[model samples]
Target: MACRCSPLLLPLLGWSALLLAPMLLVQFANAAIFVDDRGVQHTWDESTKARVAVRAGIGAVSLYHMGMREEQLAATWGLWGVRGSDFDPENPSQGSIYPEADPSPEEAAFLASAVNLSPSCWKNPRGCFQWDDTAEVLGMRDEIDFIVNIDNGSAEDSYNAAEEAGMNVIFIDTFYEYNENCRASNYSIIDTSFCYGRSMIDVAQRIEELAVFLGVEVDQNSLNQQKQAACDAAQAFTETMKDLHDKGIRVKVSIVDTELRDDTGVTTASVADFDPIELWVPRTLEELGMPLLHAASYENNEYGYIYSDEYFPDCTPGFVNDTCNGNTYFPVDFWLIDSRSFILIDDNFKLIFPDRAMLAGQYWSYPRNDGSISYVMIESLLNEYRTRLGSAVKLQDSTGTCTPADPKATAHLVADGTGGLGLNEFICYDEAAIQQEYLQCPTVAPVPPVSTPTSPTPPTANPPVPTSPNTSASSDAIMVSTITSIAAAAVTAFLMFCSTSG
Candidate 1:
């Protein structure tokens, strides 16, 4: 007969096994370990004295899920020459060879030179990693005090590395991961939909979860609570980080736009109900006690492309529905407007200095891998602006990629003006280039009075009752022409896409 186990122990053993599985997984998963000064140990090490170099990994869902493989990450940092311990059990591709020192002198000099220009802020403030890694390849470690993993790796791994290196973290909250539209934001855990991606509703939820994970226990409430319990929890968490904050391990949580939580009914609107952007502004102003560095995309057509009646004919129909004639009826690109508006309102808060309200040039600021180019000519234009402005202007390159501020202390701006005095600083070139573009634009100029030949009859004391319906008719006709052109463009676009796809 086969050996038989006790039936009574079956349930007990099963329950014990269920509990042990998570414990075992936790132990195995605790690749990064930390210890405080008193010898207290923590599963994920987040406290350290070494500076952090945050890297935004490339935009690949598969890569993101797999986490940061060692060899892949090593290639990113050029670890072939750098000698150090290679302990990555997860990825075998990592090389044992390591650089004895930092990047080459030429690269360090290049980074040093690049940091002086503004608008070349941090690489991908959102979550794209290519730009982030490029900064490291160029030897920004000497300049950047900390390398917070924007999308450098999984949150756990990133925190672990930061702790191991003794660097602070700039934890960009993920709204879609816990929002009602969790499934909808399929591409990125954090939506890249401007204001929608950074709304407070999503932010509040994300912050609460992050706080709990960071080993804090603030009171939280259900999602639908009329009062903002999530916001409170976030505020509490930020306050609690004070302990680590005192240790010089500061954490900054940012929302790219203010209107993220507002109900704008646009694609860029956040699915979360909380208004974290709005809540963050005042608190960031009052509680954080640090001058808020508010950045926003300006008003313009998507990608700053002039897709007029010339490019997209099908857009005409959409334009027709909005106006009497199609001229002024172009679609507002609500999503773009809302995102820009969110940041614009923040600029309106006079307390925020002009430098703080750095105007992000266009919505799609960076070059897309799929052949999309940046709206503004960054290199040539900014260089010209810097040359013209003299000492009155300061530019800070945000890691020579897509951040709003430079890593070095220099002002990272192409061109900036004095306070609300309505002064416009030139970023591209002298007044001539701007004037030429202004002239070429489609905006109608004010029509001046025509000096027509006088009739033989002397003018009556009161001018004969003017009976020119032509002016009104012309205005109406212009409007109609504009509307028709836009509608035609949009319809043409739709049909073209369909035909091409099919």
Candidate 2:
């Protein structure tokens, strides 16, 4: 131990010691000492930290309410065991009581192997405070070192029961109450008006705090980056929509529940059917500078009526009278059908507004609240706008077209070959029969009137050739060829002049 080193090695050893000091400090920092709500302190090294188990109800509801952020983070980091159940909406109590009926094998295995802190409740003939039975049912009674409970009337009994069973209890109500108080103090009246419940941001912040309380290391930087990316995508989409609007290429869209079709197959569901918080799609579009048709009128309607109950008694709300007040709100450039609706409703909408486009699928589903608007959803919306609006612009530039006809004047219900009445006749700019029937055709008097006349009829016997949009590609190639030839000739002449001078 007393062996001497050379003078040259002394500096190298000192430098090595300086470099290793922070590494040793980090190793020591990784050992966490967490204090539970009961004033009980627990220590764990890096290898044997406590395992977490989220209640089954929390996992089920968080999917639609909080975007499943907590579950996703836990699964990705392998820090927690998730309890899942086969949810039955008709009999909701079955899911909360049963642990063996879990549908996901992966989740079940995680719960069985890694659960040491149980934050769950069970119901019986008595009530929901049976913590010992819940722990035994979840197969975590032997291994569970702590029981986390909410400090509310609903969970106070459960906390006492767990403590009576000789287990430490940690109350999580302070985290939730703190966030609620912060929101009340900081949020403006308008901001509070938009909020339906605890927002995704609140959920995320609470999760981060809970992780710290449980001595779990979370990738907070990565989570913030993901959230920032989503906000950036939403902002980019808004800017794109603003640019399109400035170019006078406004795409009017209407959200309809096609499931509520009338006898004549016309959609009876209007903006009145949905609550203010559920109208996230229209609200987001309006925020992005793209106002949806009839949304404002419906929002501001004095009587809060959008459709008549005379024709659609089954679908209309009970407050509606027998008068059609919102017949003029149907015409729009495109329709966004509710995801719950039938696919055949597309035909019904086409018969009513013949020139309009439609997009359907789960992405266009109803109840589009704050939790539903993710980064992927924003990207999808941007793609739809680009595809639909780009095609319309290209078509209009090539073909001199007018605005679609008034739906009220053109659309009519006619008797089908069968005994039923169906939506049959509608006028559109593309329809040849409607064009000939009108004294002034849309081709003759194009909407947003173009300066160049694009009439097929001319004074000469031989009509002039019509220019197709495809010709631009060939024209560009020809111009490139001409420029290349001129450049080659100029270069050759300059070389000849130099040779002659020499």
Query: Please, what is the TM-score per model?
Result: 0.21, 0.35
Compared with the true structure, model 1 gives a TM-score of 0.21
For model 2, what is the alpha-carbon lDDT of residue 245? Answer: 41
Model 2, span 246-309: residue lDDT tens: 4434233323332456554544434233222124344344334442333232323221333434
lDDT of each: 0.26, 0.35
Give the winner by TM-score. 2
Candidate 1 residue 447 Cα shift, in angstroms, is 63
Model 1 shows how many backbone clashes? 64
Candidate 1 lDDT:
0.26
The residue pairs found clashing in candidate 2 are: none
